[model samples]
Target: MNFKKIMQKSMGFYFNFLSFVNPKKLKKDGFELFCNPFARKVKPHQLEFLQKGISDVLDLEGYQIQTYKWGSGSKHILLVHGWASHSFRWKNYIEHLIKNDFTVYALDAPAHGLSSGKSIHVVLYAKVINAFLELHSEIKSIVSHSIGGFATTYFLDQYKEHTIEKVVIMGAPGEASDFFDFYKETLGLTTKSLNLIIDEFYSQLGKLPSYFSSAKFAESIMVPALIVHDKNDLATNYYYSIRLNKHWKNSELILTEGLGHDLKSKELVKQVTEFVLN
Candidate 1:
């Protein structure tokens, strides 16, 4: 077997064994592992690009969130990146927004980029977005990718009072259960271990994993939005966006054939800029 498969099997064996011996420890450690993201080192180009922006840090619930600002236009925009990704992922989008005279803002989500955290969840990310919005109330436009898109939608749903004008959600998952299933499969977790972890998740978040659905959140968001998804995206299925679009009354859905999940292209930047600007 391959190394990754072997490691996954080993981890499954360990967690299953722990479940029989000490279920409590398995719940705590398994849940934490599920939330923790692999650390990504900043590249030289990414660092250089990030250095051009005005930098600030916000202390929210003990996590230090690193934020960046660029441009000085009257219209403001925020860029929210995907899971395991940092603010640097928006380099092209930032340039496009700046060229369009938009005061662009971006943040490295907790546990990603320069932020100070070891683990993250969608609710925590929504709180982080809320904190940033509190500070920059003028920001009325948002462009988000993957989990960032889901968190943005959640923030909008929870905090109804805001100045948000337009939003772009790209390659975002519709259901939180999708992640839990992926985690279970990746680790080859036993049903008992998975159930224990789910219980821990509920104890911490006060909601079952299936309760956190972007489609459900979209139902409450009235802001005009553009939902972009790739038909062949292996990370997040395109059907999620379709389901979300049906619920988001004022949203538009765009399907691309082969852009994949990241959706990084000059054409997409142009389309998103147009959606936000006009």
Candidate 2:
């Protein structure tokens, strides 16, 4: 087996053993492991790309959020990246937005890029987005990928008062339970172990895993939205976008083939730009 498979097997064995011997410790450790991003290494090119934009750090709830801005257009736009990803992922969209004369903003989600934190969850990420939105109420357009999309929808759902005009969500998971299911399957967690982790999650967040559904959150978000997903996206099933689109009322759905989760194509950039501009 490869290194990843070997690690998964070892983790499964370790957690299973802990479940039988020390259920209390298993809950704490499993919850932490679930929240941990594994911290993707920042590439030199990515760092250089981020440095090109004006940079600032915001201290929010004891976490330092690294933000970047480009262009000086009267209209403002924001970009939110997904799990295990940083702002560099928005380089193509940023270039396109700037060329269209948009003042673009992007942030490194907590624990993902230069931000300070060891762990994160959808609720915490939503709060981070809320804090940034509070500062830049002029930002009316947003483009988000994966979990970033989920957090954005959640923010709009809870806050209910904002200046957001348009939104674009790409390859975002519809249900938070999907993440827990994936984690349980990947680590081969025993039922008891998974239950312990679920309990711990509730203890920390005061909500069940099922509470963070994007489709459910979409019902409350009344802004015009563009939902793009690939039929073959392995990271997040496109069906989630289909489900979210059905409930989003003012949203449009674009189902593409072979683009996978990133959805980084010139054509997609054009579609997103046109949607934001028009």
Candidate 3:
């Protein structure tokens, strides 16, 4: 390589190293930085539309932009957005649910949007679902994404009588234990930093910070699950989908190439409709 190119590369590395070592960056807690473009890592335009829909549905006059909701019905469907995402991310899916005559609810899990709190995990996320289910009834199915997919597995383990009839897991995880490890590697977080994150997470909850592998949940869960994932998704990868199929008692897995992590569309609508009807 040319000397100029080598020097530029060295400077780039130094810049990144300096940023990571900055004390100011480390001292600020999770909530202090409620919405980081880097932390969230993703956003969709549909969020605005969905936020408006939520207000219209509730006939609310104010706007803190509550990104979660309990649809006005016993029989219903649900869509769960991923980590650092607002529930409004499911606008396309919501339209399909309404068109198919399904009352739908979507949750913007803690720290993602209007929901109170900071960064969250599958266990706490599942607890929110459990809390909602206890009050509601006739929940028909779920269409969940990424970490939302992992959280659903936590719920499958907890519910005994199978209140959830069907589930469409889009880019879900197969092994919860592996999730944070992936986060660690992707963000270059040391074991010490990972432990600190877990500690912070614990301070926020009674549940432990582990969403460990529950192949048992898949095997024992009677709900019909459809695992939709992209082969090229750098986030969760495809292993989770394969594992869901392997362990699930009644699941159909579809592996799509070139789609990456965001796999919502007309195809998703059709597949979701078929699963709910069946």
For 1-278, candidate 3 gives per-residue lDDT tens digits of 78866664554344335346752333234213222312252244555565555442221122122334534543488777776676666777776666666777776676656555545656667867765665546676888888788778778887664578888888976664475465455445556555554554455554443545646567768788898899899877797688778888788988888878888567867877788777
Candidate achieving the largest TM-score: 1
* Clashes per model (N, Cα, C within 3 A): 0, 0, 1
The order by descending TM-score is 1, 2, 3
TM-scores of all candidate predictions against the true structure: 0.98, 0.97, 0.72
Task: Give per-residue CA lDDT, model 1, range 78-142, as digits (tens).
Answer: 99998899999999999888888899999999899999989888999999998899899999999
- Model 3 spans > 4 angstroms off: 1-48, 51-75, 183-211
Question: RMSD per prediction, one decimal?
Answer: 0.8, 1.0, 6.2
The local lDDT score (0 to 100) that residue 164 gets in candidate 1 is: 94
* lDDT, model 1: 0.92
TM-score of 1: 0.98
